[model samples]
Target chain A: MEDTVEQPKAHGPHGYSARKDDHVKRLRRIEGQIRGLQRMVEQDEYCIDILTQVSASTKALQSFALSLLEEHLRHCVADAVEHGGPEADDKVAEATAAIARLLRS
Target chain B: MEDTVEQPKAHGPHGYSARKDDHVKRLRRIEGQIRGLQRMVEQDEYCIDILTQVSASTKALQSFALSLLEEHLRHCVADAVEHGGPEADDKVAEATAAIARLLRS
Candidate 1:
Protein backbone atom coordinates (compact mmCIF):
# COMPACT_ATOMS: atom_id res chain seq x y z
CA MET A 1 0.00 0.00 0.00
CA GLU A 2 2.79 2.37 0.80
CA ASP A 3 4.44 1.67 -2.52
CA THR A 4 1.18 2.37 -4.31
CA VAL A 5 0.95 5.88 -2.94
CA GLU A 6 1.88 8.34 -5.66
CA GLN A 7 4.36 11.15 -5.10
CA PRO A 8 3.12 14.70 -5.66
CA LYS A 9 3.67 16.15 -9.09
CA ALA A 10 6.40 18.78 -9.47
CA HIS A 11 5.30 22.32 -10.16
CA GLY A 12 6.91 24.12 -13.12
CA PRO A 13 9.36 26.96 -12.53
CA HIS A 14 6.68 29.43 -13.58
CA GLY A 15 4.11 30.29 -10.90
CA TYR A 16 1.37 28.56 -12.86
CA SER A 17 -0.63 27.97 -9.68
CA ALA A 18 -0.92 31.69 -9.10
CA ARG A 19 -2.85 32.22 -12.34
CA LYS A 20 -4.42 28.79 -12.68
CA ASP A 21 -7.87 29.84 -11.52
CA ASP A 22 -7.90 32.92 -13.69
CA HIS A 23 -6.86 30.94 -16.74
CA VAL A 24 -9.52 28.30 -16.09
CA LYS A 25 -12.21 30.93 -15.68
CA ARG A 26 -11.22 32.60 -18.93
CA LEU A 27 -11.24 29.27 -20.76
CA ARG A 28 -14.70 28.48 -19.38
CA ARG A 29 -15.99 31.81 -20.61
CA ILE A 30 -14.45 31.14 -24.00
CA GLU A 31 -16.21 27.78 -23.95
CA GLY A 32 -19.48 29.62 -23.39
CA GLN A 33 -18.74 31.93 -26.28
CA ILE A 34 -18.17 28.91 -28.54
CA ARG A 35 -21.59 27.60 -27.58
CA GLY A 36 -23.17 30.92 -28.47
CA LEU A 37 -21.55 30.80 -31.91
CA GLN A 38 -23.07 27.37 -32.51
CA ARG A 39 -26.50 28.65 -31.60
CA MET A 40 -26.19 31.52 -34.02
CA VAL A 41 -25.28 29.12 -36.81
CA GLU A 42 -28.21 26.79 -36.05
CA GLN A 43 -30.78 29.59 -36.00
CA ASP A 44 -29.86 30.81 -39.50
CA GLU A 45 -27.89 33.74 -38.20
CA TYR A 46 -26.00 35.92 -40.69
CA CYS A 47 -22.79 34.37 -42.04
CA ILE A 48 -20.83 37.50 -41.24
CA ASP A 49 -22.10 37.43 -37.68
CA ILE A 50 -20.98 33.85 -37.19
CA LEU A 51 -17.60 34.61 -38.71
CA THR A 52 -17.24 37.60 -36.40
CA GLN A 53 -17.88 35.40 -33.38
CA VAL A 54 -15.38 32.83 -34.64
CA SER A 55 -12.75 35.52 -35.09
CA ALA A 56 -13.40 36.81 -31.58
CA SER A 57 -13.08 33.33 -30.09
CA THR A 58 -9.83 32.69 -31.95
CA LYS A 59 -8.45 36.01 -30.72
CA ALA A 60 -9.32 35.09 -27.15
CA LEU A 61 -7.37 31.85 -27.48
CA GLN A 62 -4.36 33.68 -28.97
CA SER A 63 -4.40 36.21 -26.14
CA PHE A 64 -4.51 33.41 -23.59
CA ALA A 65 -1.53 31.73 -25.23
CA LEU A 66 0.42 34.98 -25.24
CA SER A 67 -0.17 35.54 -21.55
CA LEU A 68 0.93 32.01 -20.76
CA LEU A 69 4.06 32.51 -22.87
CA GLU A 70 4.88 35.72 -21.03
CA GLU A 71 4.59 33.91 -17.70
CA HIS A 72 6.88 31.12 -18.94
CA LEU A 73 9.53 33.61 -20.10
CA ARG A 74 9.40 35.65 -16.91
CA HIS A 75 9.64 32.66 -14.62
CA CYS A 76 10.87 29.44 -16.25
CA VAL A 77 13.28 30.89 -18.81
CA ALA A 78 14.56 33.45 -16.34
CA ASP A 79 15.26 30.78 -13.75
CA ALA A 80 17.11 28.54 -16.19
CA VAL A 81 19.25 31.41 -17.46
CA GLU A 82 20.11 32.40 -13.91
CA HIS A 83 21.17 28.84 -13.15
CA GLY A 84 23.52 28.95 -16.19
CA GLY A 85 24.29 25.45 -17.38
CA PRO A 86 23.23 22.81 -19.86
CA GLU A 87 19.78 22.96 -18.29
CA ALA A 88 19.60 26.67 -19.04
CA ASP A 89 20.27 26.01 -22.71
CA ASP A 90 17.61 23.30 -22.70
CA LYS A 91 15.00 25.68 -21.31
CA VAL A 92 15.71 28.36 -23.91
CA ALA A 93 15.63 25.92 -26.82
CA GLU A 94 12.39 24.47 -25.54
CA ALA A 95 10.84 27.94 -25.31
CA THR A 96 12.07 28.91 -28.76
CA ALA A 97 10.40 25.85 -30.25
CA ALA A 98 7.13 26.69 -28.53
CA ILE A 99 7.21 30.29 -29.74
CA ALA A 100 7.85 29.10 -33.27
CA ARG A 101 4.80 26.87 -33.14
CA LEU A 102 2.61 29.67 -31.81
CA LEU A 103 3.74 32.08 -34.48
CA ARG A 104 3.22 29.54 -37.25
CA SER A 105 -0.38 29.19 -36.14
CA MET B 1 11.54 50.63 -45.60
CA GLU B 2 13.87 47.64 -45.98
CA ASP B 3 13.67 47.04 -42.23
CA THR B 4 9.89 47.05 -42.43
CA VAL B 5 9.96 43.90 -44.53
CA GLU B 6 8.94 41.14 -42.10
CA GLN B 7 11.09 38.05 -42.20
CA PRO B 8 9.31 34.72 -42.40
CA LYS B 9 8.74 33.09 -39.04
CA ALA B 10 10.99 30.18 -38.07
CA HIS B 11 9.58 26.66 -37.98
CA GLY B 12 9.72 24.50 -34.87
CA PRO B 13 11.84 21.36 -34.99
CA HIS B 14 8.64 19.29 -34.80
CA GLY B 15 7.52 20.02 -38.37
CA TYR B 16 4.30 21.59 -37.14
CA SER B 17 3.32 22.26 -40.76
CA ALA B 18 3.06 18.53 -41.35
CA ARG B 19 -0.04 18.34 -39.16
CA LYS B 20 -1.14 21.93 -38.87
CA ASP B 21 -4.16 21.30 -41.08
CA ASP B 22 -5.25 18.33 -39.04
CA HIS B 23 -5.01 20.30 -35.81
CA VAL B 24 -7.01 23.18 -37.25
CA LYS B 25 -9.70 20.82 -38.53
CA ARG B 26 -10.09 19.16 -35.15
CA LEU B 27 -10.32 22.54 -33.42
CA ARG B 28 -13.03 23.62 -35.86
CA ARG B 29 -15.02 20.49 -35.07
CA ILE B 30 -14.61 21.15 -31.38
CA GLU B 31 -15.90 24.65 -31.97
CA GLY B 32 -19.00 23.20 -33.61
CA GLN B 33 -19.56 20.82 -30.71
CA ILE B 34 -19.31 23.72 -28.29
CA ARG B 35 -22.02 25.52 -30.20
CA GLY B 36 -24.18 22.43 -29.93
CA LEU B 37 -23.77 22.44 -26.16
CA GLN B 38 -24.81 26.09 -26.08
CA ARG B 39 -27.96 25.24 -27.98
CA MET B 40 -28.75 22.47 -25.55
CA VAL B 41 -28.62 24.89 -22.66
CA GLU B 42 -30.65 27.53 -24.45
CA GLN B 43 -33.39 25.03 -25.18
CA ASP B 44 -33.46 23.93 -21.54
CA GLU B 45 -31.97 20.55 -22.31
CA TYR B 46 -31.33 18.14 -19.47
CA CYS B 47 -28.42 18.98 -17.20
CA ILE B 48 -26.80 15.59 -17.64
CA ASP B 49 -26.93 15.84 -21.44
CA ILE B 50 -25.26 19.23 -21.46
CA LEU B 51 -22.67 18.09 -18.96
CA THR B 52 -21.93 15.08 -21.11
CA GLN B 53 -21.27 17.26 -24.15
CA VAL B 54 -19.02 19.47 -22.10
CA SER B 55 -17.10 16.42 -21.01
CA ALA B 56 -16.75 15.25 -24.57
CA SER B 57 -15.55 18.63 -25.69
CA THR B 58 -12.98 18.74 -22.92
CA LYS B 59 -11.77 15.26 -23.86
CA ALA B 60 -11.32 16.37 -27.45
CA LEU B 61 -9.16 19.25 -26.32
CA GLN B 62 -7.11 16.89 -24.17
CA SER B 63 -6.58 14.53 -27.05
CA PHE B 64 -5.45 17.37 -29.25
CA ALA B 65 -2.98 18.45 -26.60
CA LEU B 66 -1.62 14.92 -26.32
CA SER B 67 -1.09 14.69 -30.06
CA LEU B 68 0.74 17.99 -30.11
CA LEU B 69 2.90 16.85 -27.21
CA GLU B 70 3.74 13.66 -29.04
CA GLU B 71 4.80 15.62 -32.08
CA HIS B 72 6.95 17.93 -29.99
CA LEU B 73 8.70 15.00 -28.34
CA ARG B 74 9.29 13.16 -31.58
CA HIS B 75 10.65 16.14 -33.45
CA CYS B 76 11.81 18.95 -31.19
CA VAL B 77 12.93 16.99 -28.13
CA ALA B 78 14.55 14.28 -30.16
CA ASP B 79 16.47 16.81 -32.20
CA ALA B 80 17.71 18.59 -29.09
CA VAL B 81 18.86 15.37 -27.44
CA GLU B 82 20.81 14.47 -30.55
CA HIS B 83 22.38 17.93 -30.71
CA GLY B 84 23.64 17.47 -27.11
CA GLY B 85 24.40 21.03 -26.10
CA PRO B 86 23.05 24.03 -24.23
CA GLU B 87 20.29 24.51 -26.81
CA ALA B 88 19.21 20.95 -26.21
CA ASP B 89 18.85 21.59 -22.51
CA ASP B 90 16.76 24.69 -23.18
CA LYS B 91 14.36 22.76 -25.39
CA VAL B 92 13.84 20.05 -22.81
CA ALA B 93 13.14 22.56 -20.04
CA GLU B 94 10.69 24.42 -22.24
CA ALA B 95 8.85 21.20 -23.00
CA THR B 96 8.87 20.13 -19.34
CA ALA B 97 7.23 23.37 -18.33
CA ALA B 98 4.58 22.97 -21.02
CA ILE B 99 3.77 19.45 -19.90
CA ALA B 100 3.41 20.71 -16.36
CA ARG B 101 0.79 23.23 -17.41
CA LEU B 102 -1.09 20.66 -19.42
CA LEU B 103 -1.13 18.18 -16.57
CA ARG B 104 -2.22 20.80 -14.08
CA SER B 105 -5.21 21.66 -16.25
Candidate 2:
Protein backbone atom coordinates (compact mmCIF):
# COMPACT_ATOMS: atom_id res chain seq x y z
CA MET A 1 0.00 0.00 0.00
CA GLU A 2 2.86 2.33 0.77
CA ASP A 3 5.56 2.65 -1.84
CA THR A 4 9.13 3.64 -1.14
CA VAL A 5 11.54 3.33 -4.04
CA GLU A 6 14.31 1.90 -1.86
CA GLN A 7 12.38 -1.01 -0.44
CA PRO A 8 12.64 -4.50 -1.96
CA LYS A 9 9.37 -4.97 -3.82
CA ALA A 10 7.51 -8.06 -4.98
CA HIS A 11 5.18 -7.02 -7.75
CA GLY A 12 1.58 -8.18 -7.66
CA PRO A 13 -1.65 -7.12 -9.35
CA HIS A 14 -2.60 -3.43 -9.68
CA GLY A 15 0.93 -2.10 -9.36
CA TYR A 16 0.85 -3.47 -5.87
CA SER A 17 4.26 -3.71 -4.26
CA ALA A 18 5.27 -6.15 -1.51
CA ARG A 19 7.93 -4.02 0.07
CA LYS A 20 8.45 -5.31 3.53
CA ASP A 21 11.65 -4.88 5.52
CA ASP A 22 11.03 -8.02 7.53
CA HIS A 23 10.77 -10.05 4.35
CA VAL A 24 14.14 -8.86 3.24
CA LYS A 25 15.59 -9.58 6.65
CA ARG A 26 14.24 -13.12 6.55
CA LEU A 27 15.73 -13.66 3.13
CA ARG A 28 19.07 -12.52 4.49
CA ARG A 29 18.79 -15.12 7.22
CA ILE A 30 18.06 -17.81 4.66
CA GLU A 31 21.08 -16.67 2.75
CA GLY A 32 23.15 -17.07 5.88
CA GLN A 33 21.86 -20.61 6.34
CA ILE A 34 23.02 -21.40 2.85
CA ARG A 35 26.46 -19.98 3.56
CA GLY A 36 26.71 -22.03 6.72
CA LEU A 37 26.06 -25.15 4.70
CA GLN A 38 28.82 -24.17 2.36
CA ARG A 39 31.24 -23.87 5.25
CA MET A 40 30.12 -27.19 6.67
CA VAL A 41 30.95 -28.82 3.36
CA GLU A 42 34.39 -27.30 3.28
CA GLN A 43 35.06 -28.53 6.81
CA ASP A 44 33.81 -32.06 5.92
CA GLU A 45 31.17 -31.92 8.60
CA TYR A 46 28.86 -34.90 9.19
CA CYS A 47 26.02 -35.60 6.75
CA ILE A 48 23.32 -35.13 9.40
CA ASP A 49 24.58 -31.71 10.23
CA ILE A 50 24.21 -30.61 6.66
CA LEU A 51 20.76 -32.14 6.46
CA THR A 52 19.54 -30.08 9.38
CA GLN A 53 20.68 -26.88 7.74
CA VAL A 54 18.95 -27.87 4.53
CA SER A 55 15.73 -28.48 6.40
CA ALA A 56 15.96 -25.10 8.01
CA SER A 57 16.53 -23.39 4.69
CA THR A 58 13.57 -25.12 3.06
CA LYS A 59 11.21 -24.14 5.86
CA ALA A 60 12.45 -20.60 5.70
CA LEU A 61 11.84 -20.42 2.00
CA GLN A 62 8.36 -21.86 2.40
CA SER A 63 7.50 -19.34 5.07
CA PHE A 64 8.49 -16.52 2.78
CA ALA A 65 6.47 -17.96 -0.07
CA LEU A 66 3.38 -18.19 2.10
CA SER A 67 3.66 -14.59 3.14
CA LEU A 68 3.84 -13.38 -0.41
CA LEU A 69 0.93 -15.56 -1.40
CA GLU A 70 -1.13 -14.16 1.43
CA GLU A 71 -0.51 -10.62 0.31
CA HIS A 72 -1.38 -11.50 -3.29
CA LEU A 73 -4.82 -12.76 -2.37
CA ARG A 74 -5.64 -9.96 0.04
CA HIS A 75 -4.58 -7.09 -2.18
CA CYS A 76 -4.66 -8.27 -5.78
CA VAL A 77 -7.77 -10.42 -5.68
CA ALA A 78 -9.71 -7.97 -3.55
CA ASP A 79 -8.88 -5.09 -5.82
CA ALA A 80 -9.72 -7.07 -8.92
CA VAL A 81 -13.20 -7.87 -7.61
CA GLU A 82 -13.97 -4.31 -6.57
CA HIS A 83 -13.21 -3.44 -10.14
CA GLY A 84 -15.19 -6.65 -11.08
CA GLY A 85 -15.10 -8.70 -14.30
CA PRO A 86 -13.76 -11.95 -15.75
CA GLU A 87 -10.48 -10.80 -14.28
CA ALA A 88 -11.86 -11.43 -10.82
CA ASP A 89 -12.77 -15.00 -11.62
CA ASP A 90 -9.43 -15.61 -13.28
CA LYS A 91 -7.52 -14.21 -10.32
CA VAL A 92 -9.48 -16.39 -7.93
CA ALA A 93 -8.67 -19.50 -9.91
CA GLU A 94 -5.04 -18.57 -10.28
CA ALA A 95 -4.70 -17.84 -6.56
CA THR A 96 -6.48 -21.06 -5.66
CA ALA A 97 -4.13 -23.08 -7.79
CA ALA A 98 -1.17 -21.36 -6.22
CA ILE A 99 -2.45 -22.16 -2.74
CA ALA A 100 -3.03 -25.76 -3.73
CA ARG A 101 0.54 -26.00 -4.84
CA LEU A 102 1.79 -24.55 -1.59
CA LEU A 103 -0.26 -27.00 0.42
CA ARG A 104 1.03 -29.86 -1.68
CA SER A 105 4.55 -28.86 -0.78
CA MET B 1 27.19 -12.79 -6.76
CA GLU B 2 27.68 -9.08 -6.56
CA ASP B 3 26.94 -7.22 -3.35
CA THR B 4 25.14 -3.95 -3.60
CA VAL B 5 23.11 -3.04 -0.57
CA GLU B 6 20.58 -1.10 -2.62
CA GLN B 7 19.92 -3.88 -5.10
CA PRO B 8 17.03 -6.28 -4.60
CA LYS B 9 18.68 -9.34 -3.05
CA ALA B 10 17.56 -12.95 -2.51
CA HIS B 11 19.88 -14.37 0.10
CA GLY B 12 20.75 -18.05 -0.12
CA PRO B 13 23.68 -20.04 1.29
CA HIS B 14 26.94 -18.25 2.08
CA GLY B 15 25.24 -14.90 1.98
CA TYR B 16 24.92 -15.45 -1.72
CA SER B 17 22.78 -12.75 -3.18
CA ALA B 18 20.52 -12.93 -6.20
CA ARG B 19 20.84 -9.27 -6.89
CA LYS B 20 19.78 -9.18 -10.45
CA ASP B 21 18.56 -5.93 -11.84
CA ASP B 22 16.75 -7.76 -14.60
CA HIS B 23 14.76 -9.75 -12.08
CA VAL B 24 13.60 -6.62 -10.30
CA LYS B 25 12.69 -5.07 -13.63
CA ARG B 26 10.61 -8.12 -14.48
CA LEU B 27 8.84 -7.82 -11.12
CA ARG B 28 8.08 -4.20 -11.86
CA ARG B 29 6.54 -5.28 -15.14
CA ILE B 30 4.36 -7.81 -13.32
CA GLU B 31 3.24 -5.07 -10.95
CA GLY B 32 2.29 -2.96 -13.95
CA GLN B 33 0.28 -5.87 -15.38
CA ILE B 34 -1.69 -6.04 -12.16
CA ARG B 35 -2.40 -2.33 -12.30
CA GLY B 36 -3.52 -2.71 -15.87
CA LEU B 37 -5.99 -5.35 -14.72
CA GLN B 38 -7.35 -2.83 -12.24
CA ARG B 39 -7.99 -0.30 -14.99
CA MET B 40 -9.65 -2.88 -17.23
CA VAL B 41 -12.19 -3.63 -14.52
CA GLU B 42 -12.93 0.05 -13.84
CA GLN B 43 -13.80 0.36 -17.54
CA ASP B 44 -16.24 -2.60 -17.22
CA GLU B 45 -14.39 -4.80 -19.68
CA TYR B 46 -15.74 -8.19 -20.84
CA CYS B 47 -15.21 -11.26 -18.68
CA ILE B 48 -13.09 -12.86 -21.34
CA ASP B 49 -10.92 -9.77 -21.51
CA ILE B 50 -10.35 -9.86 -17.78
CA LEU B 51 -9.74 -13.59 -17.87
CA THR B 52 -7.07 -13.11 -20.47
CA GLN B 53 -5.21 -10.69 -18.26
CA VAL B 54 -5.53 -12.99 -15.29
CA SER B 55 -4.04 -15.78 -17.33
CA ALA B 56 -1.13 -13.59 -18.27
CA SER B 57 -0.57 -12.62 -14.66
CA THR B 58 -0.62 -16.24 -13.55
CA LYS B 59 1.92 -17.20 -16.15
CA ALA B 60 4.17 -14.37 -15.14
CA LEU B 61 4.04 -15.34 -11.48
CA GLN B 62 4.68 -18.99 -12.30
CA SER B 63 7.68 -18.05 -14.37
CA PHE B 64 9.11 -16.13 -11.47
CA ALA B 65 8.55 -19.03 -9.12
CA LEU B 66 10.31 -21.36 -11.51
CA SER B 67 13.37 -19.16 -11.63
CA LEU B 68 13.60 -18.97 -7.86
CA LEU B 69 13.23 -22.73 -7.55
CA GLU B 70 15.98 -23.24 -10.06
CA GLU B 71 18.27 -21.04 -8.05
CA HIS B 72 17.43 -22.85 -4.83
CA LEU B 73 18.50 -26.16 -6.35
CA ARG B 74 21.71 -24.87 -7.81
CA HIS B 75 22.94 -23.07 -4.74
CA CYS B 76 21.29 -24.28 -1.56
CA VAL B 77 20.90 -27.97 -2.40
CA ALA B 78 24.32 -28.27 -3.88
CA ASP B 79 25.91 -26.72 -0.85
CA ALA B 80 23.90 -28.86 1.51
CA VAL B 81 25.10 -32.07 -0.05
CA GLU B 82 28.72 -31.09 -0.23
CA HIS B 83 28.55 -30.64 3.51
CA GLY B 84 27.32 -34.27 3.60
CA GLY B 85 25.05 -35.16 6.51
CA PRO B 86 21.45 -36.03 7.30
CA GLU B 87 20.99 -32.43 6.28
CA ALA B 88 21.99 -33.30 2.73
CA ASP B 89 19.29 -35.89 2.35
CA ASP B 90 16.73 -33.64 3.94
CA LYS B 91 17.59 -30.85 1.54
CA VAL B 92 17.31 -33.13 -1.47
CA ALA B 93 13.92 -34.35 -0.36
CA GLU B 94 12.80 -30.84 0.35
CA ALA B 95 13.92 -29.62 -3.03
CA THR B 96 12.30 -32.58 -4.75
CA ALA B 97 9.03 -31.96 -2.97
CA ALA B 98 9.16 -28.30 -3.81
CA ILE B 99 9.67 -29.14 -7.46
CA ALA B 100 6.79 -31.57 -7.42
CA ARG B 101 4.53 -28.92 -5.97
CA LEU B 102 5.54 -26.45 -8.65
CA LEU B 103 4.81 -28.97 -11.36
CA ARG B 104 1.42 -29.72 -9.86
CA SER B 105 0.49 -26.10 -10.17
lDDT agreement with native, every candidate? 0.57, 0.55
Give the count of colliding residue pairs in each prediction. 9, 17
- Write model 1 residue lDDT over A1-105, tens digit each, in one string: 112236232323133434655655666677777667545534434323343454566556556566666766676667768889999898777777666554444
lDDT of 2 by residue, B71-90 (tens): 66666777777889999899
Question: Best-fitting candidate, measured by DockQ?
Answer: 2
Give fnat for candidates 1, 2 and onward, in order: 0.03, 0.00
What DockQ does candidate 2 score?
0.04
lDDT of 1 by residue, B26-84 (tens): 76788776567545544435333343454566556556666666766777677778889
Q: Model 1: which residue pairs collide? A: A89-B90, A90-B89, A90-B90, A90-B91, A91-B89, A91-B90, A92-B90, A94-B90, A94-B91
- Please write out the lDDT profile of model 2 over residues A1-105, one tens digit for every residue: 343465544433232243444554665665565556555544445334444445555555566556655666677777789889999998899877766555544
After superposition, candidate 1 runs with Cα above 4 Å error: A1-14, B1-105
Q: What is the TM-score of each candidate against the true structure?
A: 0.47, 0.44
